[model samples]
Target: MSDLKKEAESLHKAATALRKVSHHTIKPLHEFKAESDDLGALGKLGSLLGATEDIREGMHTLAKLTKQLDEEWQAEAKLMGDVSDAFDLLDILLAAAAQAKKG
Candidate 1:
């Protein structure tokens, strides 16, 4: 249906935006970590880096899974609901990453 197509397009846009933001957000942290000499700070940065990578991977997987859904499944209300929930979580994770970058 047209509505489903619209939803898919919206999701695709969100995914693309998140990908771009996350890349910009993560790249500096990586460079800083590599340049830093403090061991304690490096350990903490390592953990944050790992978490950001996990979040990125999760977003990619969710997008792929959404794409894998057949047309009949995509039409189901539950499918959209589930995908929306996943996006919500991704948004939260991205917000946390952004906050961390700010701090």
Candidate 2:
């Protein structure tokens, strides 16, 4: 894989780590203390943060996967191009050898 793709994959993994940490480990200040008339707001805010982190992480993973797939496709295309060039060279060489033998 190309370096860009590999780097993207690593970044994606880091984002996933962030999400897991946020979900299982990160606690809100509210989880520790004072309830207000807007305690529901704090709960909502916490949920929003978690959801955003999860979605951001998912997006990163998708981007990396797409890049890796593209790189793989490009590598295959290059291999096929090389094979075609080799075939053309062989054809010319064989044609020239046959013509010389016609003497």
| Tens digits of per-residue lDDT for model 2, 1-103 | 4343444455445444433443442244234322322235446665776764555455556555655665565565555555545555666676778889996
* TM-score, per-candidate, Cα-based: 0.32, 0.48
lDDT of model 1, residue 40: 48
Tens-digit per-residue lDDT, 2-100, candidate 1: 344456557666544544444453565555444443334436665766764554555566544544443334355445555766666666676788899
Q: Which residue pairs show backbone clashes in model 1? A: none
- Candidate 1 deviant stretches above 4 angstroms: 38-103
lDDT of 2 at 69: 60
**Model 2 weakest lDDT span, ten residues long:** 29-38
Candidate 2 at 90: error in angstroms? 0.8
